[model samples]
Target: MSEISREILSVGDLNRAIASSLEERFDAVWVSGEISNFKAYDSGHWYFSLKDEEGQIRCVMFRGRNGQVGFVPQSGDLVEVGASLGLYVPRGDIQLTIQTLRRAGMGGLYEAFLKLKARLAKEGLFDLERKREIPAHPRSIGIITSLQAAALKDVLSTLARRAPHIPIVIYPTLVQGPEAPSGIVAALKSAAKENAVDVILLVRGGGSIEDLWAFNDEQLAYAIAQSPIPIVSGVGHETDTTIADFVADLRAPTPTGAAELAAPRRDQMLQELAAIEQALSQRIHQRVEREAQTLDQFALRLSHALPNPERMREQIQHWQQRLKQAWLVRVDSWSRNQSHYAQQLEMLNPQRTLERGYAVVLNAKTGLQAVRNPDELNTHSAFEIRLADGVANVKFAELESRKS
Candidate 1:
């Protein structure tokens, strides 16, 4: 064999090379073990060693990351952490730089939570269109929660303050442990069957993921979705969410918030009613004024349209005077005509001619015929001569034929 090639390196250089290699090879990884030698500095940084019976690993969670851990870890607490392997150049020792931390079993629970959430979301349980609207003015309210839960007091007090007139129904049930999901479902069914409440509130106090895991049950989510009455879920704190929250008709940040949303405030409703009354009164007043104005205009038009009685009387008197003048002229003309005709009749009277002494001659043989020629009187023929009142018989003494 050829002489072995030799490369000499200082301790710091050696440790830097090892640290770089470990980081490049491992990336971030999760490891589980019981915590030991845990330490907290004033800077809020956490230093600890994770160990099991067979092996142990040194770990450090910086201040920036550990602040979000949500709890201070004690020695011998089982924890799982996501960390990158590295060698501390200063100490020249292997260690892990923790980026995340959680209780050992939380990882599995979180994974299940994500899986169920995805499946239910794909089935349209979380669709916005499927959600119902909470009644603005519910006649009654139902509460489904643990009787021992502190959240119950909060919701009750809030509803009482906002809408005391509304009736409240409580359906007590377990909010945790293995039996919580079924208990909640039973209470929901009872409330639905009774149908006494317009809205239902599903509430629980704040807790860790494990403490609140019962709300994540698949059956409870389905039950909430199937309820006919609108459900308002107020589970855990604002940051805490579960499957029931997604399936409920509405999600409130807190139990008090659910109560507030379920019932309308009495004082606020009164204000709205007052405003409506005022608007109606104003509209009625305006309508009446408009009608009164229209009536006044009609009255003015009627005064002009009606005929005057005084003018009618004057017209009648003028026609009467003209008629009287025509009648008098006709009467005078008729009386003059009658007087002229009477005078003409008197001039033509036959008795007046007889009184003038004219006499009628008649043949004496019949004593009724008048003689017109001298031949009727041959020698000694008798004839009657009649004056106005007497007749006398006479004979012709001498006959002379000289007159024609």
Candidate 2:
């Protein structure tokens, strides 16, 4: 060994040198391990230990790098980390500064999917309001999938069984592999340009994350959103979900399901039409019966309300006769009363009483009676004596007093 290399070095200096050498050798390497003793500081840095059955290493993921992680990590989770080896100068401990941390296998894809979903959702791509409603009865359907895909077969069989009258136009494209997303996007655009189909069915058979990754493409999702045609995404099995599913106008569980959604059963429509016809017939029959009854009532009312001049004149004459009779009776009663009252008045009248040998004397000037008592009489009195046929005048100088 060289004498310089043999010289003693402090622990910090040695750790720094070792760290530099380790980074130089493996600046970026993938390490697979389970996490333990995870700690997230207020500074947005993550400190943890990556461990295996027999070995472990200290790791740190700073705020800048970990912010890109869509999810928080838990202890004991299996993870794959891309990092560089480093040592803490203060403690002289071997550690890794994680540049990227991903859950192993499909977890990485899930994280990316979640990230894109959040971004697109915030941008309103997956808004329920923006989603186009699928037609209840599409005249024709455009399918974008590989012609050899089992999904195509399933969809065709379902459509044929459910609604044989509806025609289908297939826009064939790759559904898997790296080039699949662009191909699928092109097919969608072509279908939209054709404008022949009421709705577009974007479908594929279920597969692994890698195989279905094409459906998760951001551009493909945007294309589906902007397409003039409504798209039903049936890209995978019931449990599988992709970015296309969210951005699509509708998501079906399988290709057959998408066919069912797009096409209404012919038998069901026939039954509905029959029901409507029967209901209309019943409503018309009831309305006709009701109107006939109303017409009969109206005829009766019209017959009653019809004017007859002869009958009206007869009624008027009858009323007039009755009124005349009533007036005559009243006149007779009044005549009888007048005759009876005239007899009474004649008997009571002073002139008539005078004719009956009784007289009424009243003061001539005032035409009032004077006192019969001599003590109350005026010395000179003038009176009008009323007789049966004429009036008589009398004067008296004194009143006569007679002893009993």
Top of the candidates by TM-score: 1
TM-score of each: 0.56, 0.52
Q: In candidate 2, where is summed lDDT lowest over 10 consecutive residues?
A: 364-373
- Candidate 1, which segments miss by more than 4 Å at Cα? 1-106, 305-404
lDDT of 2 at 202: 92
- Residue-by-residue lDDT tens digits, candidate 2, 178-285: 999899989988888878899999999997666788999999989999998999989889977999999999999988899888998978876785676567556655
Each model's total of backbone clashes: 1, 2
How would you encode candidate 1's per-residue C-alpha lDDT over 91-158 as one tens digit per residue?
98799999999987434567788899999999999999999999887878999998779998899899
- In candidate 2, stretches whose alpha carbon ends up further than 4 angstroms from where it belongs are 1-106, 307-404
State how far residue 309 of model 2 sits from its true place (Å): 12
Model 1 — TM-score against the truth?
Answer: 0.56
Model-by-model lDDT, in order? 0.82, 0.80
